[model samples]
Target: MSEGISVVRVTSADLPPLHGQRFDQAIAEGRHGEMRWLAEKADRRQSPKAIWPDAKSVLVCGLNYGPDSDPRATLGMGNTATISVYARNRDYHDVFKGALKRTGQWLASRYGAGVKVFVDTAPVLEKPLAQQAGLGWQGKHTNLVSRSFGSWLFLGEIFTTLDLPPDPPEFDHCGSCRRCLDACPTGAIDAPYRLDARRCISYLTIEHGGPIRRDLRPLMGNRIYGCDDCLAACPWNRFAKAGQELKLQARDDLRAPKLRELAGLDDPGFRALFSGSPIKRIGRDRFVRNVLIAIGNSGERGFLDVVATLLDDTAPVVRGAAVWALRRLAEPAQAAAERARRLPGEADATVRAEWTEAMD
Candidate 1:
């Protein structure tokens, strides 16, 4: 019998060690580019035993947070920001952690056993642990795809000293479907199951510090916070309905923020707007960086004034991206004249390069 949530139990010995090898190889090959933390914490992320020495059983839990509507529907709406559904409202790390604490406390009280909860914050290889516990298998997009909820599950884990019964591992069922791979605008999914985070729009937008690659910017469109293209392309998502988590549901404003409005946000204003949302983690400058990319891709001249003002923003990344956007919307000579005046005072090498490129 399955509750709305899927639970997986695994022993230390049954944990997925292969993830370590693959993660290591990816890090060594630079596939995990700019996210050096993955390599920094690789050892502990290998398994439950690595995180907790005395752990005998691991409980992997899946909470479905599917969106009410197709997030991809906003992709063509060039003038607005398209935030990833998971981040539109509240931060899941906070919401999920609260849920896990309550659940873990109940389990501890009932069994009188020692328990520890680990959400996305910990270096836990949750997807492998979830599959090992039989919640779902990793689809070709490298995300756990549930037959019930598709690609919209948020994973959490509990490591307990009690030796509990473990469920069988779920096997792969992606077959030959390459919809997710082909659907990536930046070709982040280079192969069936392999993901190059460097080329990933989500990584470039949210994680990577400083300016994004010049060549990849055009493919990013209006996706400001994170991308949901591959997840949206999953055929298994036909079963996904509206998410029920009050804290995780899409906020009306975040559903589609105008790029121009987002572009004009100062640091304090940005903080107030994204207060509890995960989008705030990227900070005002980075968030503005992402918005500038969307403004450039929007092919709309409405953002010219905002984008031009942002050329003088404190953050080099924001200034550089604004330069890119202005170049896209401004006339060649108009952009050149603005650059000729602004370039004299701009000190950041990256922003200077963007000005040079805009002139070209």
Candidate 2:
């Protein structure tokens, strides 16, 4: 196909064994955090055969969703939230699913075989399969980096009973570059291709449904959603162009929203604001919790009023996050008064820890 989209084929057996082994190891080491779904369906996640016995070949496809401007440019905007490049647009699962289904239908009709498609929600090791398919090699950042699309491609796959010719696999192009490794804000990418999700800003903001590790909060900066430091640092992305898909383009409202404004969103307001975006999946509580983290990191006196309103949020996690933000923005005398007023009424041990952690 002449279109930017390309499809490559690989067998289930071609899917590397180490991918599953790494999953087990990550789970065993407790690196996955509260995303228990990764461990719960791990048997199926381990291999393609575990999902469908008759599937002989997997057709991996990818679409580029690269940003027009560098995403890392927003990291210094401490008073505002830094949503990830991908989440700044409509959800990829929704935007890419349509293209995948159409492509799958065309393939099935031509090849006369049954097919099933999957994007992120599936248990498939998509990056490994994409690498197996010659879509790209998984760079040191542990993301697929294409010669053409760099690290900005969103992958999907079609499992089929019909066998197809497999393409030559892509090999490591990251020879000496440690830009991705060194750029991580939280040291999440501890070593080449090894990500400790527990220390990742994306996991802390989106998946881990608890107060973030106090030690890592300041390092998180203003990344209220996913962090892109590692991805943005990859030199291969010089080839990336803005995604042509209109639905996948960045929305003006999501680009660089101010922390104070986002901190004030009520339940319905949050839902309505992120209605079509993937950020909505975390719900208002966690979303506000992240905004509060950014507010705490902002070090801006103007956010005091916004953070104060959330001090009594219904969700304990939100309240706890607000406590941290208030402490960061308040002067010594004001913080003491607020701490004295709130400590006795705090019911959750974790929230209480936030108050005590504040004193430290």
Candidate 3:
């Protein structure tokens, strides 16, 4: 019973139907694909209180990270890889956590009790909590959509012992619009609010380890990192404004970098290029693997030399992707000659197998 603390008891009816039971089921069924962490704590992810018993109410907040220009405008440039809007600058998890922590500390100082800050790192189902906090409603893509920021906002939360009056939940305004579902290149969003991460381009390129599925590779286009087709296609974004935070603004180097240049990056080069950017987390091997796939899609034979250099790469993953790119770049005879040179020295069996297949 903290002084000046308002309280609003949420009825069971006010909670999301089944209380995120469907999300749990989706994870359990392997719909989350390579994101094993989500499935590891499936039960706790459904309820905020389950994460911390002392938590009486959850304070959810949103940070608008919308770009001033169209995020999709760079796609037509062909050679450049499109990094998702969220990853353009400092990682949102680090940026938003700092903001949430400051807000939580202030609330804790006033309330004098339990308080915790959570960004994407926690198991909390942030979208539902945001909706419950009256921040926004879950849109058709299952992402929280704010009237103020639309779907371009990043969500963070503060769990506290203080019994603050809960804001009424926002109503879903998606009404009859299926743009998000229709726009998904991989059909990741099966229905209005359901997303199968296995089919999601973002999940395949970023979250999933190892080589991407053969079928999904071409569909990825030049999006080497994450896909924003679903988010960009949303009509709600018309109301969204560019983020005021300096750290979240898009960098010019990343806007539309040439695919050939990206494919040519060595380990040191990759580190220097992506320093302080979220794309650095994927490392050079995976980054090159993605670039090679994009080179194959570019239909530009100019990148063949860049792809050829990676045939001798230390990492098998990169080599395999290079082999795949060579097959796409040249006629069978030329691809076969390139594959023959690497097949003898290839250390990884998987890469050797891919090279052998290319030579045949």
Index of the highest-TM-score prediction: 1
TM-score, candidate 3, is 0.92
- Stretches of candidate 1 above 4 Å error? 1-16
lDDT for predicted candidate 1 compared with the true structure: 0.85
Cα RMSD to the true fold for all candidates: 1.8, 1.7, 3.9
CA lDDT of each prediction against the hidden true structure: 0.85, 0.84, 0.78
Residue 216 CA error for candidate 3 (Å)? 0.9
lDDT of 3 at 180: 91
C-alpha positional error of residue 63 in candidate 1 after TM-score superposition, expressed in Å: 1.2
Residue pairs with colliding backbones in model 3 are 6-165
lDDT (10s digit) by residue, model 3, range 10-37:
2111245475788877876778898888
Residue lDDT tens for model 1, 1-360 = 133343444544346557888877888889988887888999887777888888888878777789888898888687878999999988888887777777778779999878898788788777877887877888888899887789999998878888887777888988889999999999999988799999999899889988999999999999988899999999989977677778888889988888878888998999999999888888999989999989999888877888878888888989999999999998888898999899999888888999999887
Q: Residue by residue across 187-300, what tens digits does model 2's lDDT show?
A: 898889888889999889888887888889889889999988988888988877778878878999888888878888888999889888999999999988998888888888
Order the numbered candidates by TM-score, best leading.
Answer: 1, 2, 3
**Which residues of candidate 2, in runs, are more than 4 Å off?**
1-13
The candidate, 1 or 3, that scores higher on TM-score is 1
Query: How many clashes does each candidate structure show, in the order listed?
Result: 0, 0, 1
